[model samples]
Target: MRPEGIRLLPWLIGAVDLVMIALATVLAIRLRITLPIFSAAGDVLENTALASVFFLGTWLVLLVYSGAYEPHVFGAGTEEFKLVVNASFFTAALVATMAYLMQYPLSRGFFVLYFPLGVIALLVGRLLSRRVIQRLRSAGHFNEKVLLVGTPGYIGEIHTVLARESWLGYDVMGCLVPRDYAGLEVTSAGVPVLGLSEDVRAVVDEVSPDVVFFTAGAVSSSTQLRRLAWDLEDHAHVQIIVAPNVTDVSSERVRIRPVAGLPLMHLGRSRSQLATNDAKRAFDVIGSLTVLALTWPLLVVMMLWIKVHDGGPVLFRQTRVGRQGVEFTCLKLRSMAIDAEDRLTELEARDHVLFKSADDPRVTRPGRFIRRFSLDELPQLWNVVRGEMSLVGPRPPLPTEVEQYEDDMLRRLNVMPGMTGLWQVSGRSDLSWEDTVRLDLYYVDNWSMVQDLLILARTVTAVLGSRGAY
Candidate 1:
């Protein structure tokens, strides 16, 4: 069942949005009045109050039409912000059109100030609301209880994901398995088998889940699934979600179409188009130049420190695999002794996929400090500028590591290696080889400008905290 607290989320968000909109309108009017071009010389307060009410009511209506107040979208994802932007623009345009059509004097400067202010206020309000809701959800106050109806393997995968992503607000209560499986519990995934699939209705009645996630092969046929849905509909308020067998592919790349009453999911190819590649390159160039400009002084200081500490090269150059298995000169601030490479074979292997040590003896004192906060990686920004790497992408693998890669693992080579990537912000040296590869591949599949910006933002926090940094 839906949590009572969660049921009130839409109302809370709507109230927050309305107040923010009204405040933004008033603020816009006050700012506009100061400008000679939009001077409201008399009765400013009365006019501003009327405008605030009109704008708030119109904006709220637009927001409702834009699906901003939908329960499914509350306290999650970019959809809320996108909807707010759309509604704001639409409301402004409608107001302007109405004034023009009715031959009423409407200050263009007022809208010029209002549109952005309204959107920003609404977005900030929603962000604050989301934070509050997430805190409540984390404390188990507002969460949708999920019941899994699937095989042990599928249940395990779904359960692991839901558990890891607690912000998704799904609390997996238990699972219902096929009758053939005699196990009472799934200890590997930590989900108890509530009942068999045949008794799914009874289990739902007993457990009273808000959501039922049916994994592939959960039922024997489409007919049985329909019957289960019908039974649940009459019994309780339950949302049914069918989990497709696909993994890691984004919704942007998947298209569902009905052909002759059969729904078919078409998967788009992974390769980026020319425009996307050009945009990515432009972002990399701009980001690299900006960072270089800001950090040159710090870079010089680090260079001198490294040279004074080791009397060796300030920069370390190594051959690393780039896109399509091509070799590139990867650069980094030298963080180890001159003979660190010679000691690689002497040290115990940490992992077969990526070699790293928490406390390698070859690291110099300065190296330890720099590597701890990833100052050593600052030089890779040069590689990004050189076009051999990106500001964000998969972690570049060594030539030897690439040679050891299985066919599936080589998919990491499909995109340019990055200076800081999903793997780096997630856990740098502490991640398992499998997890590192998975995160990298996910970045490859789901590359977006927003994702890169988010990773860069997280990188700052990760570096400052020095978590999982060696």
Candidate 2:
């Protein structure tokens, strides 16, 4: 897409939102008043129609004010949906307050219904828009040209991430390395060198990029950054973004505190520090019981299948490390031969930390089918109900695996082991040992109720896809 056409993307989103809000308004009137669209004329109906126009105007204004239409939030992250929700609820409250103060007899039912309808419609519309935009980005449309400035290693790190997540729509046009490293032609990640980092403004002007990303080591000091910012004021179309060295931290944990013109990022405590509380415990217990109640019959069938496969034990109980380094009996339906543990020392290990193989000879016929869709994990729900596990957390490691953990890896022990976690949803046994540890640490540092819910939701898709399950 042309730059000018790209500029209209936000307006296009606004147009889609306008239609969604209008549909909500009509639906709210229909449901609340039980009348056709603006028909069956009466004072109350006439007043309601007029009030809806005001509501529509207020909703659009609030959406824009909430930054829902900003280009940065176009098709990625939770910011756009969060803004839509906040704006919808705020508009509802504001409208209700104005009506009460003005002594206008607005239909209470319509007022209550409209905002919720609008929120749902807007959210659905936004999700659909995201799908379309992501497809376009994959086809090389609606992408922002990004120019990077930093040391080669830092620039390469940023480039690697952008290249991996195409849906983020960042196209690395080129980069500027420190003057001492100007002899290099391209970054390790293959981003071509455009100029010296000290001459960032000239490079940016010459490249005409949509975004200029300054990673650590891009400037000698804050004064240099300030001076560069001042100089770049002429390039009104370019956006300057400074990236800290941190990665995998959630936005909820970071607060921007600007003191004396310096921005400081204050990170909140990790979930391991706070530990599990009554709310998470309650969610675990309730979620486990609910899932168990629905799947008990399936569980029984799996047990029977496993038992019949080899006339072996139906349940496989193994010692696994739990919260605070405690050991618990982690249970799963038997997916291997009775002597599988005895053969562990004989088989070659695929992963350095975790033991898994796609075609292990110990796996019985029933094991392959159950392991494919993770039906073997159903038995662990009982562990969750017993309080030895959670509905979502870091994957429980075996006692042997715990012995190999470094000090940083020990942080996973702070939270209760989970039936399914970031590891399970990500790739199960397919992830590299380092990637598994990184994801677990990220979850331990940034776990939240909402995040748990989202992970649970993704777990279904992951299980169905069975991309990495052994």
Candidate 3:
């Protein structure tokens, strides 16, 4: 694949904004015509057509400013969505000012309603489009292929990285290590490195990768780095990426800046520390209560169905590890038999092959469906409402599970556990125990509110697809 393959990538974002802007226009117009309750007495010269064009321009500017279309960038995280929302408000305000100056002043109510509506629509549209794009990329369409080119150590590290980050969508065909380190064994899990670094150009010629990413030690000199770039130019389509030697420092803290005569990369920690205040707790409580209130009907129906089918208590509770390693009896709608754990020994004896059994007989008729779509987890909203959990965070592991954790695995307990999380959204039951650790660590390392929202949004699709569910 070539760089051109990713062209018009920006247009996909633009089209999403365009569609959302159109939707907002219709929503605004419908509100005006059909909802007398929302009708305003104030006069505004801003015509609907003009408003639409303004919104279109606003969305375009925001998408560009937000860097939503940056090549090879895809995450549902807060930074991405914050950009969408920030862009939306600025555009709305600009439009309102334009209206005022042109004697088309919009009512304050219209502006207030319009801004939220537009932002919501834009976010919803991006999320839906993200799901479709993720599906396509996961299925291996529209994803870039990379030929790992580095020293054996670097190659091995990168191979491990590529193997773990399946959502990033880079299919590592194989790796190319230095000739001195040739024939070295590594986890060729699925991707294998084809050749040595001595024949970098030959590797490029043979593999024709979309991007060539080199680690620091492989090309030790600045001259070698420049030469690699020049050699890649022969292909004219392959991109060159350089990974630095800096360790443990987050990307947020590491900023590359150009100083007098050198390219100086500065390091600074991210400013947004984990929010731990009464305000956030209050916000969580109110938000969860509102959601729980609205979804009570569905919850009642689900409870009834589970009770009728399983003939047991509707709610399940277990003392799981929580933030700061505190224990909390997390609540959930029971989606397994009362004696399901008792069968664990039997199931384990019957299968040393896989950790899960798709045909487990312990699940009741309705329990199976609840578990599949994760409806069984809905009762945890009470925990969310009670401040025992968050809307998004690391998953709370059972106390026994925590006891068995390796040093690295315990990193997952750094934050409050949530009803949904990166592990649940990424692959759920499909993930290997190792991959599960990797994802949990990944979220703990790079967590943000935006990342939480993105995880939550992706979770919806994952639940709908029932992929990797037991």
Q: Supply every candidate's count of residue pairs whose N, Cα or C atoms clash at under 3 angstroms.
A: 0, 0, 8
- lDDT for each residue of candidate 3 in 1-470, tens digit (9 for 90 to 100): 45454575568767877888778777776666556776554343255655666667766876787676676555333446667777777787777777788876455555666668888888898777766676666677667778766776666677676666555667777766665667754534444657776677888887678877786566657777678777777676787777776644445556778887567889764322363446546756776788788988988999999888858999988898887788988888887788988887766432212255778887778778888888888788888876778877767788777877888878777767777777788788777777677677766766565666677777888889898876
Error of 1 at 320 (Å): 1.7
| Candidate 1 C-alpha lDDT tens digits along 1-470 | 46777778888899998889878887888887787775554665565566666777888999999998888887555667778888889998888887789765556677688889888898779877876777677677678999999888899999987886677789999889887786667636889888888787899888888999999879988788889888887755688999989987756568999998667899877743321398889998999999989998988998999999869999999999998888989998998899988888988897567888888898888888889888888889888888889988888999989888988888788889888888987778888888898888777776767667767866887899898988
Using lDDT, rank the candidates from best to worst. 2, 1, 3
Model 2, 179-292: lDDT tens digits are 889689988789899888778778876778998899988988999889988878988888899999889888878999999988999988786655498999999899899999
The TM-score between candidate 3 and the true structure equals 0.84
**Residue 88, model 2: Cα distance from true site in angstroms:** 2.2
lDDT of 1: 0.82
State how far residue 429 of model 3 sits from its true place (Å). Answer: 1.8
- What is the alpha-carbon RMSD of candidate 2 to the true structure? 4.2
